[model samples]
Target: MSLRTGETIKFRSVGERTEYAAKILSADEDTIVIETKPGARPELSAGQYVILIAAETNYNAQIMSADASQVRLRWLRTDKQEYFRVDDFFPVVARKVEKNLLDTKASMTVTFSKEAIDRSPPDETIHPKLWDLLVSLDEKLNLILDRLNLEPEPVEAEPQQVNISASGIRFMIKDKVEQGDMLEVKMLLPTTPMVSIVAYGQVVSSECLGSAGYVVAVQFVNMDSEVRDRLIQYTLNRQREIIRKQRQLE
Candidate 1:
């Protein structure tokens, strides 16, 4: 099948379930070139075979050439199953779910509402005088809070290199978590207006790295459509940025 330049695609080694995100740099009917993050690049050599998933269809491809940044593959045949996934990094915080916390969903909604309001465009129909007055009042309130030292300092999670997709995320943590454990995950995406997401995940895998910590993989559960769309958009934008930078270097 034909592929477009700069289109995001997913691929993994034959017989492997873990997929990696890549961007199609160039393509033709028989051969295609793709680029991936240096860290996420698939371990491949010339003549190796892999599966490429694009546009919801899977294809078997033989690696024609491979390097740290790019790979060339010759299409072999198509598979029957449909698959899709993309990965990227963002700042994230995760914790084991507490059975006593009944208000977690409410807290998540409040956080999302605040971020939505902050990023939304001003109402064009509002009266100019009323808008100015509202802005003035907000400023005054901030000034008063500052004078009283009452403004709450924002609590931010330490940034980590996470492999995030719409379905789940994988990252390293100091603590170990057992498989099948439930976790509350919060991720901050550095989009144009920024997005903060809170979702519940079930731990699927956890591997100890000894002194380095543990690599934990979690699958998202009950994530809303809006949040999933936001994640997909962020990954697409990130892929474009990566492709642009790679082209410049070429």
Candidate 2:
């Protein structure tokens, strides 16, 4: 579902299902950058392209790297025990495409997926603030989605409640939750999770929820494979959805 590096997914809602690849440039908190072009990298606005407008049928892309002049933040990876060079992952800002939006450089509603690979070359350098945002966005979204999608089903021939907890945060769910239920997934950090991560989900069928662990036995529908996949794109695209977005981000 997540258009990862060398991976592909279809976009059905808008038009014919078009497949796209991912090119992760930088991955973090608020923002993520991807090298849209394949093969070798290019200069400013090189192969990178973006939709000059979202109304036309034809598509175009350009550099979307964030400017180096903006603010910079120190990115510390607690688990990795390393700090991402502040200016190593700067995002190049380009525009995004939609049916009808004034993002001729507007901040589009971008999302990421949890399933992505690492394409961030150690030599891939960028500005400071942008890099920090990418890292933060990636980690935050992954943690949020994992917990947000956590729900419990009532075991047959049993009487009990489905309680979910992980990392540190905890919550209780009603017995036998239907698909598409809105689960509150709070981050376990020493703080609160993003209010936006508490998203609305649709009930999906059991067969669609992949066979991962005992989760498949659950009702599985709050988000079907398609929706879940898209969310996964939004959820995991941070580091892996680069090539796909590059083709579409324009």
Candidate 3:
């Protein structure tokens, strides 16, 4: 899968080897930027550029610059940007396909095959719920995902702007989250101490943000598996209802 500007991602912190769920703020061959959540909040512009590791894929990147709005980055392996971008999008012209020029274009539109454009570093996919879950992240969470090494899909750039913020959805462990386990979360309003009704989840990812705190990514992991898929269905339904009512008022 090739990387693009708007895709969602999950990457790990290099040193402590913590996992952070993130979105690609921007990506170039040499630099990239991400907007993360929670622990890195209101203080977004001031936090340090953490060392990050990518789970499964073994992708690693360094935070070159950071702020409340975004964090700049440098990939250590390729010594380039980590995420693939529209600029990198291109069609497999039988000729250019040789040079794979189109594979490296960044114009927001490109055509390629399922096998031809392996833009992702490796082991990344477009998990349907990942982006939906990312819609409500805080500054600390922002910090975490901004550096995400997402499972990527080879996407053709669309004109619509890619969303970079978190899921406004905040998480809490219904049970103690063990290493490599699942958890639960809630849909909260976007802000510090974000609050909301209880929901279910899983721990797909985690990161120790140092003595400061821990950054973990949960994929509505188990509520669905247990409640026999009841919790997720309910949560998604509630979100739709809320959107419906919101549109009605508007």
Best by lDDT: 1
Error in Å for residue 177 of model 3: 31
When 1 and 2 are scored with lDDT, the better candidate is 1
Per-residue C-alpha lDDT of model 1 across residues 1-250, encoded as one tens digit per residue: 5567989999987657799999999987668899989987657897665778888876666688999999998764443322234455556667787522312341222122221223222887877777766754444333322222111444345556787767678988777787656677766665433456777766767999999888998766555767777777777777788889789999
By TM-score, the better pick of 1 and 3 is 1
Model 1 RMSD in angstroms: 15.8
Q: Report the lDDT tens digits of candidate 3 across residue range 1-250.
A: 3345766666544334555666776776666677677464323222122333333344334455666556677543331222211111111100001211211211111111222222333335655455434543323244222221212432221112111112212222222343333222322222223222233332334456556434454322112233323324344544666679789999
TM-score list, all predictions: 0.46, 0.19, 0.26
**What is the C-alpha local distance difference test score of candidate 2?**
0.27
- How does model 1 fare in lDDT? 0.66
Better of 1 and 3 by lDDT: 1
- By lDDT: ranked, best first: 1, 3, 2
Q: Model 3: how far is 192 from its true place, Å?
A: 64
> Can you tell me which runs of candidate 2 are displaced by over 4 Å?
1-126, 138-193, 196-204, 208-211, 214-244, 248-250
| Candidate no. 3 TM-score | 0.26
Alpha carbon deviation, residue 137, candidate 3 (Å)? 62
Error at 8, model 3, angstroms = 1.5
Question: Whose lDDT is higher: candidate 2's or candidate 3's?
Answer: 3
- Candidate 2 lDDT by residue in tens digits, 123-164: 557655667667666665454434332335322211112221
